[model samples]
Target: MLKAMVLRNIKLYFKDKGMFFTSLITPAILLVLYATFLGNVYRDSFTSNLPDGFSLSQKLIDGTVGAQLISSILAVSCVTVPFCSNMLMVQDKITGARKDLTISPVSSAVLSGSYFLGAAVSSLLVCFTALALCLGYVRTIGWFFSGKDILLLSADIVLLVLFGTALSSMVHFFLSTQGQISAVGTLVSAGYGFLCGAYMPISSFGSGLQKVLSFLPSTYMTSLVRNHAMRGALAQMEADGVPKVFVDATRESLDCTVEFAGKTVTIPAMYAYVGGMVLVLLGAYLAVQYLAERKRIYS
Candidate 1:
């Protein structure tokens, strides 16, 4: 049943030529464009902007840059999935497909899971391809690496996909029209991208802004990826000019440890956020089902 749902989504997605290109081919092309032409220019420009005395390793800075590019690119793809999925949902709702799907032997869980799985698979491929391009660029720049880093990077890509899936699932039910979904999802994704520190350090953001961003799932998701990619390099920096205390604090913060920088901070609860989002979306699905059932009875 899951396989059937997955295949159906894949087929439907590909059936639209414009969406197919936007979701898959567009990111790949943008990555190539950035790496081949724009990346060096952007890096040099950004590096020049940094003031002296605030030190960062080349690897960490580059990792952040790469992450920005990947996250920016993925943000577009993220909206694309929900935009398409919600459009499909809206169409189904109008055409009685929602009622039909609700009444089918497939449970709401299975149906929702299947849609999420399909989105997850597509998101994973796009993110992994983006990561590969970033890593290849890193290798070309002569950054250190191990087999373990590659494995961890792949795992983070998978986690990012799950994060995106959760985000899209949460947003899908809130809007009925494709245009509304696309507009709102794009806004939300952009907000998440900023809040997650995808383009800038959350630490640098004002305290109020950071506090607000703390509730966002992407903040945790992006930090998870950035930390994993930079962990070894950050560890090595401690032996160099960076203070051991600073490195320890950074490591502790990234590892989700509470004690950092002479303060006991409670770790942000990403799992709870994901669980709450799942329940909210499930409730929404049930609400829509109930409405459809009542309409049928009344009609």
Candidate 2:
């Protein structure tokens, strides 16, 4: 029954062509923007601080920029895409479908799990497609990633998708109307990239702003993706004789490692932080679901 419900929700999400494509709008816009001029901007930022008489390969710079672009798109899409995918729950509510489903013998837990699992699966489908395209683009520019990099990135995307799904479920539970979801989606799509240091590095901000952004789990998520995506490029830079100091500085400036309270956050710490937030958010959603169900029964 749970599997059927999950499949049904997935079908509903894809069957709505507008909603399906709309989920990709933010990533699409970022891709276009990056291709047009943002690519050069990032490249320039990366090379602007080179020491006197030092030069790096244009190929290396392009590869690094491509890697950063991949990280940015993945980070932003992890949240925005799931926001659209999870609209299934809102659609159910607005159409009276959820009430009808509840009247069936299916347990509320199974029905709710269907929504979460369906959204997570749908988000994974979209994000994985984006990852493939990004990898292809990087290859055309200058491929630096190893097979292991690809594997780790795939794992990171799965973790991020789960986090995004739980977050969307929690947020959408309170939204009973299309307008509410639309408004919130717009707000997130427009601002989430900046907040999470996807469009810009947190290090570029003032110390106060950087400190504030550090508290956001999405910031760490972005760092995790950036670290893996750029690992090969950074390694290549080191192999090509770039000074260690410069490479470390680049890592910090590009948010390959996030800093909290003047301390660098290690990769494992990032995973722990994001994973903890996922559990917290999912638990919160389940608690809310229980409360809502109880109220419905008593009222």
Candidate 3:
């Protein structure tokens, strides 16, 4: 029964053409823009910013383009995964399916697990697909993740997906209508990239704005992935005679690192940030779920 419930939601997500396509639209558009135009723009930025005699290498091309790809993926995944997950729950609420499920032999725990599992699986599915396609495009431009990098990226993605699922559970508790869901989807898809600094580098913003964006979990997530994604380029730049100071400048200018309370956040700190956010979100989601279950049982 648990397996069936999980499969049902996953199936519904795909079967509903509107939901399926809507979830992917922003990612597809962003991937195209990044792969085609932004990659060239970043490459040009490198050429223009560095010393006159600096020579380019494969890793330089990889770093400039790879940073954008990593940030873009993290931004889209953070929003889309949770949004799609909650949409499924909201659909169940509106259609009375959840009420039916509540009355079945399945316990509240199983039902909740199913919904989460369905969302995580589906969200991961779409994200993985997007990742593969984007990586394929970047590979042609001389940027590719090494095997070790892929494993690290995969772990980061799974954590983000889980965090997204937990967040969706909390949000879905409030979303009782399709209109509300649609409004959220439209707004997030249109604005999250900019908000998350995927469309633009946070480093370019004023210090005040940078501080504000740092509070967002997306900021840390992007920073974490961008470091792993662009580290090779840094090495390449160093090898090619670009000073470490200049490479650090490139990272700073690109929003690949963030500052908090006058200190630069490190990789370990970024991981801590993500981990802390997940715990807080999961706790809130559980509290809301318990309250909702209580109300449903009595009402």
Candidate 4:
């Protein structure tokens, strides 16, 4: 049943060639543009402001870390994944497909799991393709270590996709119409991404805004990117001519931080941030399911 549902979804997704291209190709294009245009800007920004002693050259050379952060950011905050996921749900709702599923022999768990699985696959493709584009651009412009960082980055991308899928599930539940869903999804996602340090540091915002940003899932998504990419980059910086004070200062200035895999990870505090969201989403799913079942029985 799960297989059938997944296959059906894959077919439907491809049948709409426009949607397929928009979902997969748009992000890759954006990543290429950002890496090509902003890569150097970030490099320059890092170099110019890199307090008095750090090796800006090595940080730039750490293309793996940069690619990871950029790719993950593009995947999580850009609204493409959430937009697509919400659209799928809205389509199902509008056509009465979701209502049909509610009455079908297939369990609710299977129905929800199938949709989440399809979204996960779609998101994974976007993230991988975006990273590849970023990596190619990174090679052209900077010094990036492509070995361990690549593996770590790939793991980070997978986690971000999972986090995105879980998040979209809750969004899918609340929206009553496609237009409303799309508008809210885009605005909320883009706003959170920007405010969560995906494109810039959340700390750059006023303190109140930063505190609110801390609750957002994207904050942790950025944290995962930082831990995966910038952790090594920072370690390398410390080894190079960067002063301890400057390195410490840079770490302190980070928007979020985490400790994972027996290492003290400093990026954005992505784990705690996403964990909170996941818990909330799980609770929402349960409440919706209970209400749905109760309505079905009582009515």
Looking at candidate 4, the ten consecutive residues that score lowest on lDDT are 255-264
lDDT of 3: 0.75
Candidate 2 error regions (>4 Å): none
**How do all the candidates rank in terms of TM-score, highest first?**
2, 3, 4, 1
Please write out the lDDT profile of model 3 over residues 1-299, one tens digit for every residue: 88998999899998987777766665677777776777777767767787667667765565566656755766566557568755888898899988888888987777777877888888888877777776676676666457777677677778778777877777777888989898877776677777777777788787889889888988877776677667666666777788888888888877666888878888888888888998898778767777778888899
Write model 4 residue lDDT over 1-299, tens digit each, in one string: 99888767766776777657767765665565566676676666556766655345663454533654464455453345645743576678888998998888978767776776777776677667767766666576554454787787787777776766676766776676868876865676456556557666654677676666555566667766665555556676777767877766565455434334434544444555565666677567657866777777799
Q: After TM-score superposition, what is the CA distance of residue 146 in candidate 4 from its true location, in Å?
A: 5.1
For each candidate in turn, the TM-score is: 0.70, 0.98, 0.91, 0.81
Which model, 1 or 3, shows the larger TM-score? Answer: 3
Residue range 1-299, candidate 1, lDDT tens digits: 87897777666666766655555665577667656665676567556654566566776656545544554454444434444433444555556776687778867666666677776676666566666766776665536556786786676566556655655665665556657756875676446545556445566676677666666655655555555566556655565577666656554433333222335443345435544655665466656655655676688
**Clash statistics: count for each candidate:** 0, 0, 0, 8
Local distance difference test values of all predictions, in order: 0.58, 0.90, 0.75, 0.63
Stretches of candidate 3 off by over 4 Å are none
Q: What global local distance difference test value does model 2 have?
A: 0.90
Candidate with better TM-score, 2 vs 3? 2
Best candidate (score: TM-score) = 2
Candidate 1 wrong stretches, greater than 4 Å: 25-87, 91-110, 239-241, 245-299
